[model samples]
Target: MTITPETLIAAAQSSKAWPFQEAQRLAKRMPKGKPGGVLFETGYGPSGLPHIGTFQEVLRTTLVRRAYEALTGGAPTRLVAFSDDMDGLRKVPDNVPNRDMLAQHLGKPLSRIPDPFEKFESFAAHNNAMLRDFLDRFGFEYEFVSSSECYNGGKFDTALKGVLSNFQAILDIMLPTLGEERRQTYSPVMPVSPTTGAVLQVPIEVVDAEAGLIRFTDEDGAIVEQSALGGMAKCQWKVDWAMRWVALGVDYEMYGKDLTDSGIQSGKIARVLGGHKPEGLIYELFLDGEGEKISKSKGNGLSIEDWLQYGSEESLGYYIFANPRSAKQLHGGVIPKAVDDYWQFRAALPGQELDKQLGNPVWHLLRANESHAGANAPGSGDTLPVPFSLLLNLVGVLGVGATREAVWSYLGNYVTNADPAAHPALDALVDKALAYNRDFVAPTLAKRAPSGGEVGALQALDAALADADPAISAEDLQTIVYEIGKQPEFGFDNLRNWFKALYETLLGSEQGPRMGSFIALYGIAPTRALIAEALAKA
Candidate 1:
């Protein structure tokens, strides 16, 4: 049956994780008049292609938002995918080819990196644009915020001021957490200028409200100063989380389990800085086909692009929604298997439940199926196909054309069951087709080439057909064969053998579908011509 936001939320609350309950606790403390919203942030390092892990975060957040919307019967909660492009180039990623160039741009804002494609204004923009494009393809509506924009806009001024005022407090909290040796070098934040390695011993008077500048004294007691524009934010990485919650008014956020400890640190800092803790939801990591973490920087990861080429969007959605949002590991290569299972799930759902699933965004497979079904007839607007058999049958005939519309039409007419609601067998067939499409590559039609056995079978079939009525149709030919097979010597096994012999003679294969149906679709004359060609080759 169709799963709604309420259902998902209920599921989450019932599960051991209880994210919704956690969200409720946080929601109760928020300002009474303000609507509760979730702020889902994913960092874009701008070092390499965004892997499937990135999509997982965005997709999960979007699904949660959708569920919220469904439950509230209001506009879905806002989701912002923030790109941390203002962050400096800390180190050259292992997979990036241009280490020297990237290192040359080190300590500079990610917005300043040269575009690898040489088309975008900067490397950050190129990556950001790619991410935006990918999200757009999936119909995700997110507020795109660049870290550069936030820094340049002075949105973090108050937060920065708060951080500075509480610097001693932050130091006290971090000192015990980070031993004294580590705390000495750490000033609660990192400040490295493009022109200098470390701006140490700077005067505290460099704190400019208007210019967003913060100054400090280095170990040598020298005045070292830097502007907030130079990637200097209100707080360090640990403190930044707390500052972001206040600055963006974030209510809910989820992260990978790998960062669970860091999330706790951020939550603690948030309590100190913002007087409130950001709702932190922890999710599990994704593994490759072999159950290993999919690391993009390591040049080993499955991308959304890779999945989309073979799997349907619905399948992807199914992959996301089927599992609990808890810290469960996912197998990337087995995504196809997930998609296949999702189709089966949809097919098995009650009619009304399936209808509901079709209406939900998390049920992307249903949507894809609907889109395919709708495009079946020209000028028919979009409609859903009746059953999976139509799709499989159409694929079997190799009638799936260049356009999705063509494929849809072929499926609607030939593959779908006449009455899916009533026909159990037909419904089962549809499920089988969905499984095949989800798990395996679509089969390609064999090229015409008659083998020696095929030539012999075709000669015998041709002689038989010639002796029979000239007007005998392909269907009639099947009936004739059935009649012959009724003989004790020519039973089902022999009939199968006879058909294989005929196929071998005509098409160079000992296997094929019913000759009558094949001939009817291929045309009697074309069938004869194919056999003649095969005979000539023999």
Candidate 2:
């Protein structure tokens, strides 16, 4: 289908997806034909190693930028991945080594501290490299900004001077938000200790705005005075946030919900420094397997690399596409569904309305035009004949890391006229299913004896299969499982439970493809023999 500008723009403006809608909203809010084009920023703090949560900020920003460009006839857009490496190391994370070594150097700028991993110049460099590596692996189009270089090189000089000049005004913006205790010690520009090279959070007793200088008592109680512009001192998080916008003119940005308070304060500070705040959005945090909020410093979630090992990059993109405002899980268990959901979305696209087709997540995942839809949509056009769950069951039968030839061989043995080699989606499904089994679905599974109720269900299934022809459709097999679940003597009151019994007893897992479909593919004789073995154990 030809991608007319009208369909694409309408879909972007009216979509339920947050990124698409946000891009439309923010684009309209941009100055009527501004000279600077569009700039989107994703900020990261180098306090700990980059995690899965870090990807959301950049990915979400990229999505919105893409939407904006698509809607505006491919307008120029640039994404800046900014790292706040100049920030101080408040505490050492438990994930890395040399905690004691880092703890001793707490309160120092991140760039001033030695690398606990000893692979980079400093702790900040080590963490920043990790963030870059992740972005590179995904082939993201973005520019990297180092706060340390920007500050130390005088790139932030103008903003810093403006902040110092309007010190009192910015303080009034921040002081009202702080507690009595915090207000007393707060200074917008925190000074790095001259003696220890530590970032001092102590109150600034004097500010010579005219001379671009500030004085504060060091941790040792000695008075230290320094120039604020040449990286002698750095703005606190809130001030730094505003300073970045003023210097770079970031058009859009986002942060976690927990930082809303600081965000508001920083916006006020930015206005005081003669700059408007970036268009800001809030996203809900990701939780761990146990449902606790994922934290970079706490190390409470899966690493980005870990997730990628068991799932495709497209799966991760689906997770990001989910409710942007609701707390969600980032575990391996979500990976399989993410993969399946993308397939489902693509499978429904071809016959959809122009606007609907344009808004499909598959298009955004491909990051391409509607005419280029062929690039990412899985399967032949929109007819997705196989279920991903069924392919997962194949993973179990064939085992992990099975070759393409082996998978095709297995398919040929069961399903008539099957050509797994020609199926574009088969190989990926097998890989994901095995990874899901190993990383999320395998550990909780164990050998178990079938219950009496399920024994009847299995016997019923066996009798039905005994009379069945060698060839069967997935739909036919599904109907057989449902009919068996309805028999009174079986006591398989719920059809769902009956399916669970089949998966657990026969497949040794809690979930599987439709029973009829699985049985048909595995061949009626082999399926019946497996059920017989399960019944013998019972």
Candidate 3:
């Protein structure tokens, strides 16, 4: 179909892709009379190294921004990767170095603490640079915003004054949520200690709303009067979140589902500051393999490096794109399926209708940069003749520590066009598959004893394979296996059982690549030997 603006907008309106749905919500909530188009923002707390969660939020928000732009016929839009470096360093993160040095600076803003890595001027600066570098590596289009820069450079001066003016209103919204002791000491304004240079979390009184001044006790046991604006103080997290929305004119942002209550409270504070809260999405948090919520401190989830080691960057993006609302288990075990599924989606995109294409994750992923992250390079996409799972199995049979050249040579036998130099994407897949097979698949390889019926089936299959053509296609080989299973003397109840036996007794896994593909790639003679070996063990 010929895709036009009208058709694009119509598809976007009906598309069930989370990003498009979010974009439609943003379109409805956007304010009038603003010459600047919508501003999309994703906030990051620069307390630990940027994790997969960080990448996911930015990627998802970027997708929504692209969808919004498409729905508006290329309306000007900006995405801000805002960092909250000004947040206080409550405790030393377990994952960072120089824990003793970090502990000494606890209660100070992250931008003020010395860099534990000793690379940047401050701890937060080191983290912020890492975040920017990470995002830049992915070719993401965004403007990096620093809370410290905004606060110190007077960008938030006006909003800080607005907070002082609405102090009691914010108090009314926040006090009920706090415990009795915390309620007594809670203040929207968190003044910086004059002597200690740490953020003071003491009770404070609003001195003059119009003058933007507040009175509080410093850690030095001295009463001090300071302007609440111009970096002298910052609002607590919920308050600061609201102030940011008002200050930066952010139209859209997304947060983890754990922050839903905080979002609601921030929304009220945003209105109290005379600006509406941005349209927001609260997506489910990722869980570790054990079903516990992933935490940076615990190091319980897969990091960006961990995922990339076994899969393409595009695969990681696709995994994040598939489901935002549903909690997903992020771990090493999920990588193979994610990689294969990502390629499958790309392979299927060309055959889909426009609306379906719009909904496909690959379509959205390709919208920004078709070849971003070294994925889907020339001669790739649908042209990749093999699934990652198939290559993985090939590597498994080839044994751990198999070289790329060895696997390439084996693949060339089954596919004429399988050249590592020509298919860069497939070459990359080869590298990833080798790594996956070595790390995850090889350790679990064990040939179980075949059952009596499976032995009979394997014996018959070995005989059939001995007479089969060596140059048979994978499909033909699969048909031969199927027909043998259908014979009455084999005593197979179902094809699934037959396949299960093949995997458990031959491949040593409960699941495996298609037997036809495996046989074709491993060669007819080797497959016959594998069947004989299983029969020997029986």
**Which candidate comes out best when scored by TM-score?**
3
1-538: candidate 3 lDDT, tens digit per residue: 5578888888888888888998888877752314676899998999878878889999998889888888777788888999999889998888788999899988898999999999999999999999999888888899999999999988998899898888888999999999999987789889988787788788898889888889998887789998877677888999999999999998899999999999999999999999998887889999999999998778898889989899999899899998799999998889888888888888878778888888889888876553355432322455567788889988988888689999998887687787877778889989999899988999999879998788888888898788887778889989988987888787888898889889998888888988999999888887887788788887
- Per-residue lDDT tens digits for candidate 1, residues 1-538, read 3456566545533332232344444444542215445454555555556667777777666555543443343333667888777666666666555567767776666676776567788878988898788777766677888877786677767776666667777767766777656666666555544344432322244366456566765455566666654345434666776777777877667788887777777777777776565565577776655657766655454566655654555666666654444433443445545544555655444443433433433344332222344321222212333323224433444433333433443333333344555444334444444444444423433435545444455665556655765456657877755555444533335667666655555543435556665554344555666667667766
| After superposition, candidate 3 runs with Cα above 4 Å error | 31-33, 368-380
**True-structure lDDT of candidate 1:** 0.55
Pairwise TM-score winner, candidates 2 and 3: 3
Give candidate 2 regions above 4 Å deviation. 31-33, 98-104, 205-210, 219-222, 296-299, 368-386, 395-409, 413-425, 446-457, 483-501, 508-511
Candidate 2: tens digits of C-alpha lDDT, residues 1-538: 6657776766666776666778767877872325667888998888876667677787777777877886776778788899998988886788899999999988888887899999999999999999898788776788899999999999998888888889888888888888999998999888888888888788884467767788889889988777887778899888999989989988899889999988888888888888887886798888989999876667677777777676666767877877688889877677667767877887777667767765677767667222344563333644334555666676665445555566556566454456655555555555655676555555565546799888878888899888776666767878988998988888877888888888889888887777776776666877887888788898
Candidate 2: the clashing residue pairs are 477-516
Query: What's the best-to-worst order under lDDT?
Result: 3, 2, 1
Which of 1 and 2 is the better model by TM-score?
Answer: 2
How does model 3 fare in lDDT?
Answer: 0.86
Best by lDDT: 3
Candidate 1 segments whose C-alpha is farther than 4 A from its true place: 1-43, 94-98, 179-181, 192-213, 217-222, 226-234, 324-333, 347-350, 353-538
Error of 1 at 234 (Å): 5.8
